[model samples]
Target: MKGALREALQRARVDKVPVALVTQLEGGAQNLVYSSDQSNAEISLGSSQLEEIRDMLRVARSGMLPGDEFFVRSYVPPYRLLIVGAVHIAQALSVMAAQCDYQVTVIDPRRAFATAERFQGVELCAEWPDEAMARLLPDAQTAVVTLAHDPKIDDPALIAALGSGAFYIGALGSRRTHGKRLERLTDLGLEDQLQRINAPIGLKLGGRGHAEIAVSILAQLIQARYGG
Candidate 1:
């Protein structure tokens, strides 16, 4: 039974289909197996890289077999996120963004701030702004945030985001700062792209602390993405 189940799983993996190997023992029967076709997968599961429903189905069907292991291999998507900063605000924002179905990635040229210690669960990239951005081939679903205040970094990423159809494009800066940044961006032939930016990013909750500000920013981002 175990061997048969593994074969089905292998076939499903190769075809890029999701399945659950539900097992059962009926009276004297050792094992009975069922499968949930990938097309019929019911739950969205909030981007958790696993087919937990399948695992649950398997356990329910095949009660407790000492050597039986029913688990779902992690399911990964092609989506990604790119954040440009290693500041306090960036740290907080990354945490929340990660929870919201994003494959979070943070980039910064400052080695001191961009460390495994600061970005606990993020994929940190400490390379020059333009050089780092060149590595990302964002699609329409990608989200790009320019949390770095430095023009050298923020400006480059902003330009790139404007060019791409990234679902969300936000920048961290004050009204004055954004105004000046806008002028500079216009100078770079992005005059018509001004409408694409969510400058002075985040809703007006009127808070200044690092964490609170991060909350406001991510809140707005969620609304935009989920149609809330």
Candidate 2:
């Protein structure tokens, strides 16, 4: 691999971007392609061959495309979880999400609560929900959840998330709470966007406690990702 190719691979890893390497069948000429931005390293190939590789790259974004040097090798980005609130359920959910291969990030304005001790292996952001969410920029490969149950924190995060390509947006609240939440969001001019939120988040698993709730939430997230 050339220095440029190595650097591009490293950038993809560090930035969590999906990329692909296409190699010529005869001379082993190589090209680097990014699935996120569709940027590519220099390589000589026919437009027809290039389009085929691009189609493969698109399919690879969901998972990895099978087979090797026959044509193209792809690397896909890991899915991400942007969780608002560092509460107990968040801690449990973060752990579960990590086991499910999600790059978990927990955001909370209360620095004392969003501590490294509680969320050991997860990323912690000690900023307001909206500020942190804006920096994160949840995409199609991301899941956003508001577990805080506080309007001041969760609502702002929702504003940023709903406007993004986040695959799943869930909030922790009941029917009554969601009703009140909709009213507040309507006042903020988000009435049309209310349906995007999966209020009363998590599946009806007939379980209680933080751990059970976390399991239910993860189950619903899996269902959303894989589809029914």
Candidate 3:
């Protein structure tokens, strides 16, 4: 790799940007393709090829093109899970998410709940949800879940997630609770984005335990991630 390309790849990795390196099989020509930006290419590609590269980037797949003339290798950022509450459910969810290759971060203002002993090996943020969300800047590779069950914490986090490109946003609440939550968000002028939130979060797997709920949430999250 040349110095410029190597530097760009390093920068992309640090910024958690999804990028692809397209190499011509014959001449070894190369191009760097970004998910949402212009490409840095020494070789030209048609619109269809660019679209195909984007599809591969979305799924983080690397493969040869139709004609076998070029190969695209994708470098996708690690999937991130930002939990807005450090509750019992979060403990199970964090462990499950980590096992499933998600970089999990649990955020809570309550020091007692966001303790390291409770959530071993998980990133804990003792800041308010909104503050933490602002700093995190959730993106397309990120999933945000609000399990706090408190409007003061969950609402702000939901608002932040709704405004971001986070692939999934879920809130733990009943139908009635979600209705009230919607009213509050609507009053805050987020009616249009409310559909993005999966309230009463998790699949209805007929389980009520914390671990079961975590399983359902993780299942739903995987489904959303792959467009299933």
Q: Which candidate is the best by TM-score?
A: 3
Model 1 has a clash total of 2
In the range 1-228, model 1's lDDT, one tens digit per residue, is 455555656666566443443333342122222243343233232222233444544332223433343223332243467889889998988888788777888999999989999889789998876777778756566888888899988998888888888888889999999999999999999999887788789888999999899888888777776668
Q: What is candidate 1's CA lDDT for residue 223?
A: 73
Could you tell me which residue pairs clash in candidate 1? 23-61, 49-75
Give Cα distance to truth, residue 62, candidate 1, Å: 27
lDDT of candidate 3 over 18-66, digit per residue (tens): 8999999898888889986645578899989999999999899999989
Per-residue lDDT tens digits for candidate 2, residues 63-90, read: 2224443357777778899999999999
Alpha-carbon RMSD, each predicted model: 9.3, 3.6, 3.1
Clashing pairs in 3: none
Ten-residue stretch with the least lDDT total in model 3: 35-44
Give the per-residue Cα lDDT of candidate 3 at 187: 98
Query: Mind sharing the TM-score for model 2?
Result: 0.80
The model with the greater TM-score, 1 or 3, is 3
Worst 10 residues of 1 by lDDT: 25-34
Candidate 2 deviant stretches above 4 angstroms: 1-8, 22-31, 35-49, 59-71
List the candidate 3 regions with Cα displacement exceeding 4 Å: 1-15, 23-51
lDDT of 3: 0.93
* 1 or 3, greater by lDDT: 3
User: Cα deviation in Å at residue 53, candidate 3?
Assistant: 2.9
